[model samples]
Target: MVDQSHSFYLTSSLQQKLSKLVLAAFCLFTLYFWPQRFELWLIQVVIAVAICSYFSYTIYRLKSYKSSFTLHSRNLFKFANNPNEFECKVLWVSPLLCAFYVLPNTEVEDQAGKSQLIIVWRDMLSDSNFRHLSRLLLYIRRNQASG
Candidate 1:
């Protein structure tokens, strides 16, 4: 029988997305103005600093995540080097390309502070596994709303 529960490892999609976003920001910023606009150099520098900050955050998240997440019938659990399993709630669900975005339940309005997980469908062992995970998440979400 197919297991209702499964573990998902962090994928490289996160890194790729962050890098692409950084590149896009630089491209957009440069394209917004002409090369002769020397007075607006300050704006370019400010945006560059913002991009650098995002790059640093990306690196930190990638380095700190040394674990996988186990999704069960009722709750999602994270296993890392810390030993103690961390429980998480589904803050949001969306299919981005072939992957799913998940956020831990938090009261904070900003999603950046919440732990996020991206599960890539193509990275799964089989199609059935991916389907099962999807159903499980849907079930849990429904249960949360009813109870």
Candidate 2:
């Protein structure tokens, strides 16, 4: 439903980077100071894995976007070469890290299907594009609420 074309990039602002760094530091500190308990160790491992995965995905998204199609519509579209169109749901929107979501359209059989895609502030979204996205999301929410 969107006419404005926007490109995607693996970018983050200084504020975002600093916030993430602080979070990582806090996790690391906990891992180092917490007592030598098995449960604590497990928690640390999980946190570390999550942190690594997030960073890895960020890099992967950028590289993939380089070769994938550009975002031109507000509806579901392919961001990669994969022959699948994604349906998006706006979970949350913020200046730091907006929670843009997408799910597969072929998951009609699945009972639980949800995927999150985060859009950082430094991404290539222009002011007009962001406004359009926000407006589209609001419209979707309104329709869903009514029906």
Model 1: per-residue Cα lDDT over 1-147, one tens digit each: 333567755544454556556775776677467565888778777876777687667666655544356767666554543333433455444443233344544543444455655544333334565565666666776777788
What ranges in model 2 sit over 4 Å off?
1-12, 36-75, 107-114, 122-124
Which consecutive 10 residues in model 2 have the weakest lDDT in total? 63-72
* Predicted candidate 2 versus true structure: per-residue lDDT over 9-117, tens digit per residue: 3333454555656766676666677688987888878877887678656555544343333344445545655565667666766553455566667665552464647
Residue range with the least summed lDDT across 10 consecutive positions in model 1 = 92-101
Q: What's the TM-score of each model vs. the native?
A: 0.52, 0.54
Number of the top-ranking candidate, with lDDT as the measure: 2
TM-score of 2: 0.54
lDDT of all predictions: 0.56, 0.56
